[model samples]
Target: MEKTTKHPKQSFTVMNELVLPNDTNTLNNLMGGRLLHWMDIAAAISAQKHSNRIVVTASVDNVSFKQAIKLGDVITIEALVTRAFNTSMEVRLDVWAENIPSGTRHKSNEAFYTFVALDENGKTVPIPEIVPETAEEQELYDGALRRRQLRLVLGGKMQAKDANELRAIFYKD
Candidate 1:
Protein backbone atom coordinates (compact mmCIF):
# COMPACT_ATOMS: atom_id res chain seq x y z
CA MET A 1 0.00 0.00 0.00
CA GLU A 2 1.20 3.52 -0.79
CA LYS A 3 1.74 5.89 2.10
CA THR A 4 0.00 9.23 2.37
CA THR A 5 1.79 12.43 1.53
CA LYS A 6 3.31 14.57 4.27
CA HIS A 7 3.82 18.31 4.70
CA PRO A 8 7.28 19.78 4.78
CA LYS A 9 6.77 21.11 8.28
CA GLN A 10 6.40 17.56 9.53
CA SER A 11 10.05 17.00 8.77
CA PHE A 12 11.54 20.34 9.72
CA THR A 13 14.58 20.16 11.97
CA VAL A 14 16.65 22.79 13.72
CA MET A 15 20.10 22.38 15.23
CA ASN A 16 22.25 24.76 17.23
CA GLU A 17 25.95 24.66 17.92
CA LEU A 18 28.48 26.83 19.64
CA VAL A 19 31.91 27.62 18.28
CA LEU A 20 34.56 26.99 20.91
CA PRO A 21 38.28 27.37 20.85
CA ASN A 22 38.73 23.89 19.46
CA ASP A 23 36.20 24.50 16.71
CA THR A 24 38.07 27.52 15.36
CA ASN A 25 41.09 27.76 13.09
CA THR A 26 44.15 29.98 13.30
CA LEU A 27 42.07 32.95 12.17
CA ASN A 28 39.59 32.30 14.99
CA ASN A 29 36.90 31.32 12.52
CA LEU A 30 34.97 28.10 12.60
CA MET A 31 36.38 25.39 10.34
CA GLY A 32 34.48 24.57 7.18
CA GLY A 33 34.69 20.86 7.87
CA ARG A 34 33.08 21.22 11.26
CA LEU A 35 30.23 23.27 9.85
CA LEU A 36 29.73 20.67 7.12
CA HIS A 37 29.49 17.90 9.68
CA TRP A 38 26.77 19.78 11.53
CA MET A 39 24.89 20.43 8.34
CA ASP A 40 25.04 16.76 7.41
CA ILE A 41 23.61 15.70 10.72
CA ALA A 42 20.77 18.20 10.48
CA ALA A 43 19.96 17.18 6.92
CA ALA A 44 20.09 13.48 7.73
CA ILE A 45 17.70 13.96 10.61
CA SER A 46 15.24 15.76 8.36
CA ALA A 47 15.45 13.04 5.71
CA GLN A 48 14.95 10.31 8.26
CA LYS A 49 11.92 12.05 9.73
CA HIS A 50 10.34 12.47 6.35
CA SER A 51 11.09 8.90 5.22
CA ASN A 52 10.68 7.07 8.52
CA ARG A 53 13.66 4.88 7.66
CA ILE A 54 17.40 4.82 7.67
CA VAL A 55 18.94 7.14 5.13
CA VAL A 56 22.36 7.56 3.57
CA THR A 57 23.72 10.71 2.05
CA ALA A 58 24.02 10.24 -1.71
CA SER A 59 25.24 13.68 -2.72
CA VAL A 60 25.65 17.24 -1.53
CA ASP A 61 25.22 20.27 -3.75
CA ASN A 62 27.95 22.87 -3.99
CA VAL A 63 28.19 24.76 -0.69
CA SER A 64 29.32 28.36 -0.72
CA PHE A 65 30.87 29.79 2.40
CA LYS A 66 29.47 33.26 2.29
CA GLN A 67 30.83 34.60 5.58
CA ALA A 68 33.42 33.44 8.04
CA ILE A 69 31.89 32.41 11.36
CA LYS A 70 34.07 33.63 14.17
CA LEU A 71 34.78 31.74 17.35
CA GLY A 72 32.31 31.99 20.29
CA ASP A 73 29.51 32.50 17.84
CA VAL A 74 26.27 30.54 17.86
CA ILE A 75 25.35 28.63 14.73
CA THR A 76 21.81 27.64 13.91
CA ILE A 77 21.07 25.09 11.21
CA GLU A 78 17.59 24.76 9.80
CA ALA A 79 16.71 21.76 7.67
CA LEU A 80 13.63 20.58 5.85
CA VAL A 81 12.62 18.02 3.27
CA THR A 82 11.86 19.95 0.12
CA ARG A 83 10.82 16.96 -1.95
CA ALA A 84 10.93 13.20 -1.91
CA PHE A 85 11.41 11.04 -4.98
CA ASN A 86 10.96 7.31 -5.43
CA THR A 87 13.78 6.26 -3.14
CA SER A 88 15.56 9.49 -2.40
CA MET A 89 14.71 12.82 -0.76
CA GLU A 90 16.20 16.26 -1.20
CA VAL A 91 16.86 18.07 2.07
CA ARG A 92 17.42 21.80 2.03
CA LEU A 93 19.49 23.43 4.76
CA ASP A 94 19.99 27.04 5.76
CA VAL A 95 22.87 27.92 8.06
CA TRP A 96 23.04 31.06 10.18
CA ALA A 97 25.73 32.47 12.38
CA GLU A 98 24.97 34.65 15.39
CA ASN A 99 27.27 36.71 17.53
CA ILE A 100 25.77 36.84 20.96
CA PRO A 101 27.98 39.60 22.21
CA SER A 102 26.82 41.99 19.51
CA GLY A 103 23.38 40.40 19.04
CA THR A 104 23.98 40.09 15.33
CA ARG A 105 22.94 37.23 13.10
CA HIS A 106 23.71 36.64 9.47
CA LYS A 107 22.06 34.43 6.93
CA SER A 108 25.10 32.44 5.88
CA ASN A 109 23.96 30.23 3.01
CA GLU A 110 21.84 27.36 1.90
CA ALA A 111 22.66 23.94 0.44
CA PHE A 112 20.92 20.80 -0.67
CA TYR A 113 21.61 17.23 0.36
CA THR A 114 20.20 14.09 -1.19
CA PHE A 115 19.55 10.96 0.84
CA VAL A 116 18.28 7.52 -0.09
CA ALA A 117 16.10 5.61 2.30
CA LEU A 118 17.01 2.05 3.20
CA ASP A 119 15.20 -0.77 4.91
CA GLU A 120 16.50 -3.21 7.47
CA ASN A 121 18.19 -5.20 4.73
CA GLY A 122 19.95 -2.09 3.48
CA LYS A 123 17.88 -2.04 0.30
CA THR A 124 16.52 1.19 -1.06
CA VAL A 125 12.84 1.86 -0.36
CA PRO A 126 10.26 4.33 -1.50
CA ILE A 127 9.72 7.52 0.47
CA PRO A 128 6.53 9.37 1.24
CA GLU A 129 5.65 12.24 -1.06
CA ILE A 130 5.63 15.79 0.27
CA VAL A 131 2.76 18.24 -0.13
CA PRO A 132 3.80 21.83 0.12
CA GLU A 133 1.55 23.90 2.36
CA THR A 134 2.76 27.47 1.92
CA ALA A 135 3.90 29.64 -0.95
CA GLU A 136 7.54 29.22 -0.05
CA GLU A 137 7.13 25.49 0.37
CA GLN A 138 5.34 25.27 -2.94
CA GLU A 139 8.12 27.13 -4.69
CA LEU A 140 10.77 24.87 -3.26
CA TYR A 141 8.69 21.83 -4.05
CA ASP A 142 8.24 22.92 -7.64
CA GLY A 143 11.93 23.73 -8.13
CA ALA A 144 13.09 20.46 -6.63
CA LEU A 145 12.38 18.56 -9.81
CA ARG A 146 14.54 20.87 -11.87
CA ARG A 147 17.31 20.58 -9.32
CA ARG A 148 17.04 16.81 -9.36
CA GLN A 149 17.24 16.70 -13.11
CA LEU A 150 20.26 18.98 -13.04
CA ARG A 151 21.97 16.75 -10.51
CA LEU A 152 21.30 13.62 -12.55
CA VAL A 153 22.62 15.25 -15.68
CA LEU A 154 25.73 16.51 -13.93
CA GLY A 155 26.30 13.15 -12.24
CA GLY A 156 26.14 11.32 -15.60
CA LYS A 157 23.17 9.28 -14.45
CA MET A 158 20.91 11.02 -16.99
CA GLN A 159 21.83 12.37 -20.38
CA ALA A 160 21.21 16.01 -21.21
CA LYS A 161 18.73 15.00 -23.86
CA ASP A 162 16.64 13.29 -21.22
CA ALA A 163 16.76 16.18 -18.76
CA ASN A 164 13.56 17.86 -19.87
CA GLU A 165 13.27 20.16 -16.88
CA LEU A 166 16.90 21.18 -17.14
CA ARG A 167 16.69 21.69 -20.89
CA ALA A 168 13.69 23.91 -20.41
CA ILE A 169 15.91 26.28 -18.51
CA PHE A 170 18.38 26.82 -21.38
CA TYR A 171 15.99 26.27 -24.30
CA LYS A 172 12.47 27.67 -24.45
CA ASP A 173 9.79 27.08 -27.07
Candidate 2:
Protein backbone atom coordinates (compact mmCIF):
# COMPACT_ATOMS: atom_id res chain seq x y z
CA MET A 1 0.00 0.00 0.00
CA GLU A 2 1.23 3.47 -0.81
CA LYS A 3 1.81 5.73 2.18
CA THR A 4 0.14 9.11 2.34
CA THR A 5 1.70 12.48 3.05
CA LYS A 6 0.55 14.42 6.10
CA HIS A 7 1.09 18.02 7.01
CA PRO A 8 2.72 18.89 10.29
CA LYS A 9 -0.37 20.79 11.40
CA GLN A 10 -2.43 17.67 10.96
CA SER A 11 -0.51 15.96 13.74
CA PHE A 12 -0.49 18.81 16.21
CA THR A 13 -1.54 17.84 19.73
CA VAL A 14 -2.22 19.85 22.85
CA MET A 15 -2.55 18.52 26.37
CA ASN A 16 -3.29 20.33 29.61
CA GLU A 17 -2.84 19.23 33.19
CA LEU A 18 -3.34 20.74 36.59
CA VAL A 19 -0.40 20.74 38.95
CA LEU A 20 -1.97 19.01 41.95
CA PRO A 21 -0.44 18.64 45.40
CA ASN A 22 0.50 15.03 44.75
CA ASP A 23 2.35 16.03 41.61
CA THR A 24 4.59 18.46 43.44
CA ASN A 25 7.80 17.88 45.32
CA THR A 26 8.66 19.03 48.85
CA LEU A 27 9.41 22.47 47.50
CA ASN A 28 5.85 22.61 46.09
CA ASN A 29 6.99 22.59 42.45
CA LEU A 30 5.86 20.00 39.98
CA MET A 31 8.30 17.10 39.97
CA GLY A 32 10.52 16.78 36.93
CA GLY A 33 9.53 13.16 36.41
CA ARG A 34 5.87 14.07 36.44
CA LEU A 35 6.43 16.72 33.81
CA LEU A 36 8.42 14.31 31.67
CA HIS A 37 5.61 11.78 31.82
CA TRP A 38 3.20 14.36 30.51
CA MET A 39 5.56 15.34 27.71
CA ASP A 40 6.00 11.72 26.62
CA ILE A 41 2.29 11.15 26.38
CA ALA A 42 1.71 14.33 24.43
CA ALA A 43 4.53 13.61 22.00
CA ALA A 44 3.34 10.04 21.52
CA ILE A 45 -0.10 11.25 20.54
CA SER A 46 1.38 13.54 17.93
CA ALA A 47 3.48 10.75 16.51
CA GLN A 48 0.55 8.37 16.39
CA LYS A 49 -1.52 10.95 14.59
CA HIS A 50 1.10 11.23 11.89
CA SER A 51 1.71 7.52 11.54
CA ASN A 52 -1.81 6.17 12.07
CA ARG A 53 -0.20 3.18 13.69
CA ILE A 54 0.91 2.07 17.14
CA VAL A 55 3.82 4.31 18.06
CA VAL A 56 6.46 3.65 20.67
CA THR A 57 8.92 6.15 22.06
CA ALA A 58 12.37 5.47 20.61
CA SER A 59 14.25 8.16 22.53
CA VAL A 60 13.83 11.48 24.28
CA ASP A 61 16.33 14.30 23.85
CA ASN A 62 17.47 16.26 26.87
CA VAL A 63 14.84 18.30 28.61
CA SER A 64 15.66 21.26 30.83
CA PHE A 65 13.11 22.47 33.32
CA LYS A 66 13.68 26.17 33.26
CA GLN A 67 10.54 27.26 35.11
CA ALA A 68 8.85 25.78 38.14
CA ILE A 69 5.18 24.99 38.07
CA LYS A 70 3.49 25.52 41.40
CA LEU A 71 0.45 23.70 42.73
CA GLY A 72 -2.83 24.70 41.07
CA ASP A 73 -1.03 26.01 38.02
CA VAL A 74 -2.17 24.83 34.62
CA ILE A 75 0.46 23.16 32.52
CA THR A 76 -0.02 23.10 28.75
CA ILE A 77 1.94 20.84 26.46
CA GLU A 78 1.89 21.29 22.71
CA ALA A 79 3.40 18.73 20.36
CA LEU A 80 3.88 18.49 16.61
CA VAL A 81 5.51 15.99 14.32
CA THR A 82 8.32 17.84 12.58
CA ARG A 83 9.66 15.14 10.30
CA ALA A 84 9.00 11.52 9.38
CA PHE A 85 11.65 9.14 8.14
CA ASN A 86 10.75 5.57 7.19
CA THR A 87 9.31 4.22 10.44
CA SER A 88 10.55 6.91 12.77
CA MET A 89 9.34 10.45 13.36
CA GLU A 90 10.60 13.40 15.37
CA VAL A 91 8.12 15.24 17.58
CA ARG A 92 8.78 18.63 19.08
CA LEU A 93 7.03 19.64 22.30
CA ASP A 94 6.69 23.00 23.98
CA VAL A 95 5.62 23.35 27.60
CA TRP A 96 4.02 26.31 29.29
CA ALA A 97 2.77 27.00 32.80
CA GLU A 98 -0.07 29.33 33.66
CA ASN A 99 -1.09 30.78 36.99
CA ILE A 100 -4.84 31.39 36.85
CA PRO A 101 -5.08 33.63 39.85
CA SER A 102 -2.24 35.88 38.82
CA GLY A 103 -3.12 35.48 35.12
CA THR A 104 0.45 34.78 34.18
CA ARG A 105 1.93 32.32 31.76
CA HIS A 106 5.51 31.45 30.94
CA LYS A 107 7.47 28.91 28.97
CA SER A 108 8.54 25.92 31.04
CA ASN A 109 10.72 24.15 28.49
CA GLU A 110 10.90 22.50 25.09
CA ALA A 111 11.96 19.00 24.09
CA PHE A 112 12.32 16.61 21.17
CA TYR A 113 11.13 13.02 21.19
CA THR A 114 11.65 10.29 18.62
CA PHE A 115 8.99 7.64 18.03
CA VAL A 116 8.80 4.59 15.81
CA ALA A 117 5.60 3.20 14.34
CA LEU A 118 4.74 -0.45 14.75
CA ASP A 119 2.34 -2.84 13.10
CA GLU A 120 -0.21 -5.03 14.86
CA ASN A 121 2.32 -7.84 14.79
CA GLY A 122 4.80 -5.62 16.65
CA LYS A 123 7.13 -5.05 13.72
CA THR A 124 8.31 -1.66 12.59
CA VAL A 125 6.07 0.03 9.99
CA PRO A 126 6.59 2.87 7.57
CA ILE A 127 4.81 6.14 8.28
CA PRO A 128 3.50 8.93 6.09
CA GLU A 129 5.89 11.64 4.93
CA ILE A 130 5.72 15.01 6.66
CA VAL A 131 4.76 18.07 4.61
CA PRO A 132 5.79 21.22 6.39
CA GLU A 133 3.57 24.17 5.49
CA THR A 134 4.92 27.17 7.33
CA ALA A 135 8.43 28.58 7.15
CA GLU A 136 9.09 27.62 10.75
CA GLU A 137 7.90 24.09 10.05
CA GLN A 138 10.14 23.92 7.00
CA GLU A 139 13.10 25.06 9.04
CA LEU A 140 12.37 22.42 11.65
CA TYR A 141 12.02 19.79 8.98
CA ASP A 142 15.47 20.67 7.64
CA GLY A 143 17.07 20.57 11.05
CA ALA A 144 15.51 17.25 12.03
CA LEU A 145 18.10 15.30 10.03
CA ARG A 146 21.02 16.92 11.85
CA ARG A 147 19.35 16.40 15.19
CA ARG A 148 18.75 12.74 14.47
CA GLN A 149 22.34 12.29 13.38
CA LEU A 150 23.58 13.92 16.58
CA ARG A 151 21.41 11.65 18.68
CA LEU A 152 22.60 8.58 16.81
CA VAL A 153 26.23 9.56 17.32
CA LEU A 154 25.66 10.28 21.00
CA GLY A 155 23.87 6.96 21.40
CA GLY A 156 26.81 5.17 19.73
CA LYS A 157 24.67 3.80 16.94
CA MET A 158 26.56 5.99 14.43
CA GLN A 159 30.13 7.23 14.46
CA ALA A 160 30.66 10.98 14.71
CA LYS A 161 32.50 10.96 11.40
CA ASP A 162 29.48 9.36 9.72
CA ALA A 163 27.22 12.27 10.70
CA ASN A 164 27.65 14.24 7.49
CA GLU A 165 25.28 17.06 8.37
CA LEU A 166 26.70 17.56 11.85
CA ARG A 167 30.27 17.16 10.61
CA ALA A 168 29.78 19.87 8.00
CA ILE A 169 28.89 22.38 10.70
CA PHE A 170 31.95 21.80 12.92
CA TYR A 171 34.53 20.18 10.60
CA LYS A 172 34.45 22.17 7.42
CA ASP A 173 37.21 21.05 5.02
Tens-place lDDT per residue, model 2, 137-167, is: 9999999999999999999999998999998
Cα misplacement distance, residue 13 of candidate 1 (Å):
0.4
Q: Runs in model 2 with CA error above 4 Å? A: 1-10
lDDT of 2: 0.90
Best by lDDT: 2
Against the true structure, candidate 2 reaches a TM-score of 0.93
Return the clash pairs for model 2, or none: none
Query: What TM-score goes with each of the models?
Result: 0.94, 0.93
Q: Mind giving the per-residue lDDT tens digits that candidate 1 earns over 1-173?
A: 11223354448888899999999999999999999999999999889889999999999998989999999999999988999999999999999999999999998868999999999999999989988888998999989999999999999999999999888889999
lDDT (Cα atoms) of all candidates against the true structure: 0.89, 0.90
For candidate 1, which ten residues in a row score worst on lDDT? Answer: 1-10
